[model samples]
Target: MKRQYLFSAFLAREKCLLYYQGTIRYVVVTADSGERIQLGLKHFQPYFSALGLRGRFRLTLTETGAFDSLEQIN
Candidate 1:
């Protein structure tokens, strides 16, 4: 069986008071009905910048959580 998830990814900036940096890049997504997935700057920046920033997308991942493909939804 194949497993898939629908998520809406968007760029977010989190404020950091302790660190020298003012904000950090983050990718936040609604993974399931009520689940949220967040990725740091290094994890999702490439994909988010290319397409995800626009709107929702369908994510296909392996059982081990490896990225397979991503398609933007209309």
Candidate 2:
């Protein structure tokens, strides 16, 4: 099995964090050839929508020695 990153996102309406236990299937390289992981939030749309989150939600990554926000992860 391929190594995958565990992700989490902040739900505004819930006023709390929503954890997404899933894997990133794609790896994107930057202009400098640095590898970056990409994860889609569509799978969690129902959960987020139910929480009344209209705008973009904040993502957080929870990995050993790799805990970071979405912006920092990229």
Clashing pairs in 2: none
Model 2 lDDT, full chain set: 0.39
Cα displacement (angstroms), candidate 1, residue 72, comes to 0.4
Per model, how many backbone clashes are there? 0, 0
lDDT of each: 0.54, 0.39
Clashing pairs in 1: none
Q: Which residue ranges in model 2 land beyond 4 Å of their true spot?
A: 11-36, 52-74
Best by TM-score: 1
lDDT tens readout by residue for model 1, 1-74? 34567876654333222112625555466776666655444444434443224556676777777766667675
